[model samples]
Target: MNFRIISALVMRYLFLYSRSPMRLVELAFWPVVDLVVWGNVTVFIQKNTNPEFGSYVLFFLGGMILWDIMFRAQQGVAISFLEDVWTRNLLNIFVAPVRSSEYISATFIVGMLRILITAVVLSFISWFGYAFNVFQLSWWLIPFFLNLMLFGWSLGMISTALILRWGLAAESLAWAIPFFFQPVVAVFYRVEDMPAWSRPIAWCFPPTYIFEGMRDVMKSGTMNWDYLGYAAGLNILYLALAGWLFVWVLNLTRKRGLLTKFATQ
Candidate 1:
């Protein structure tokens, strides 16, 4: 946990993005696209549905905002690691004084920074474009946002560990793995909307509880501590497991002398 090393690593990544216009656009691309597509759909539904059905824009926009948090958080770490692999720099990094913990710490910080940028930008668009303010949902927004970020970070760790062990063949997991949970997360729909057979699997994801609670608050104007509590507890467990798995995989890679293979391939 050397702060100097962590700062250096963070600066390195910042410099990479700062120099590349395409990379900066990529950070905002998917999120803005998701908001526009879903925002319009939400508006259309509101006009067509019975007024009794109530406004759905909040739910739709809220889900999209939170889901992107998870996406950006996961990509922030997993892709940062992949950048090292793509540039053949992993060996150079590890051969230096940088420890695994320090590297992860720096990536986590950068990921959070990305989340903040995305959150603020999306929040503005949802407000002006759709007349939906996520902040109005509740004060509980803070905890729910944090819970989703942690879950994303845990998933990123697992993805990185898999890539480290199997090489670039598994690099697709960095982008593909997060979407695997999207169906189960029930982001735009309730858990009940999931097939009965898949309900249990959906519940296994912590975001399911957060979204469920989000819907509860939207409908009743009250927060459900139970859902937030469940999300927090599950995040702690998953994050610990992810951390352990990453260290285990890194050790195996070193034992087999595969860092060169990971870096060069």
Candidate 2:
């Protein structure tokens, strides 16, 4: 892929965000809100449940902080894609010199940057206010975070595909899709803790393994790279399928003479 094309596309978003103070605020605002609200709730629960289980609060708070990283990664792609959709610029973007590969790369690059910024902000809040430090995960943090990022990108691509296929009717998914996986992904509980019927669905997601590994680390104070491997494997599969689905939907939309008229629909 041409770096220039990717750079241009990425810069467009960076410039857009730079110009608007509210856009900058919006980037980190909701996450801070989530951290604050959930952080307090977890603390309250810890206080009530048992003071001896001090890690209980961090369990919930840490889960939430890590969860938001994936969420922000997804929003980076889905919401950035939506900006083009909302402005009726999808056609313009496609007709330009940019290739599909370059565009997708740009989205991922942009998404990665957005998530990193959000992660830094959340880390500070988590560290200072909650007395929780994500860095404590050490080397294990890399694989889990990377897998989650891949999963988030895959989901975002699928969401973009659906919106391209179904128009504004499917727009709500950009904001809502990640939440759909929250319960099933074992963010706060182990996959086995879920019902038998739901466990099948849970395993299909990479975050399920990552969280399982995460919980194991919390409970045992040891690294379990096996779960990270599972997560990485699932992420590879998820990413392949997501890219194929997006291209397939894009082709179908084009064949149906939908791209030119997608914005109106």
Candidate 3:
């Protein structure tokens, strides 16, 4: 795209947030609550349950920190796009010189930046006071964080495409996506503690590897590169699947004129 057009779209996208600062603050609330409230609850549970429960608490917190990063990365983009629906201004924006790809690119960039900033601040807060440190050197966290965010962003785009094509039932998107990590999160409870049959299901979410890799690095001071590699491979496959689904769904919506039925504007 031309610099002039890109600059204009970027400006419009940035300024859109300026118009609603409360949304940003509201986004901050849940992550902070997770750190403070759940962090304390986990600590309490671990103390009473067993000495090994401490490790479980630590693992659970690590998974949660990463989970929040993934969730918000998706939320940042999905919510931003949905704002257009709420305001009834999406058609006007689309009628501009900006192409669909350009619009998607701008939204993704803004979403990534927002989530990065959020991760840095909250991760730091958790490290100093809450005992949740992912990287000993802190710099090692960059790759892990990037991979999770990209995985989330790809899923976010697919969800946004579906919402645009089907209906703007925002609550459905909110409820469904995070539970995909439920199996992975069960690792905190000790996968073996779960039924033998359920272990395979938990292994499906690639984030389990992501969390396992992070725990290995922080707790053992060595990288689980093999698991990391597995997580990376799964992210690539998921990305392709997400892209294909988005295109197919969008086309189907257009064919049925469902696009207008759920059109943002």
lDDT of 1 by residue, 1-265 (tens): 8999999999999999899889878888889999999999888888888775647556888888989998899988899999898888888998899999999988898889889988988999989998888888778788888999999999999999999999999988999988999999999899897899999999888999988888887778787888888899999999999999999999999899997777877
Question: Which of candidates 1 and 3 reaches a greater lDDT?
Answer: 1
Task: Name model 2 segments beyond 4 Å from true.
Answer: 263-265
Q: Name the lDDT of candidate 1.
A: 0.89
TM-score of each: 0.96, 0.95, 0.85
lDDT of 2 at 205: 88
Q: Against the correct fold, how does model 2 do in TM-score?
A: 0.95
Clash statistics: count for each candidate: 0, 0, 0
Ranking by lDDT: 1, 2, 3
TM-score of 1: 0.96
Better of 1 and 2 by TM-score: 1
Q: RMSD per prediction, one decimal?
A: 1.2, 1.4, 2.8
Task: Rank by TM-score, highest first.
Answer: 1, 2, 3
Q: CA lDDT of 100 in candidate 2?
A: 78
Question: Among these predicted structures, which one has the highest TM-score?
Answer: 1
lDDT per residue, candidate 3, 49-140, as tens digits? 97875665776677677787888777766766777677777777756786656666666677776787677767787887677665562654
lDDT of model 1 at residue 249? 96
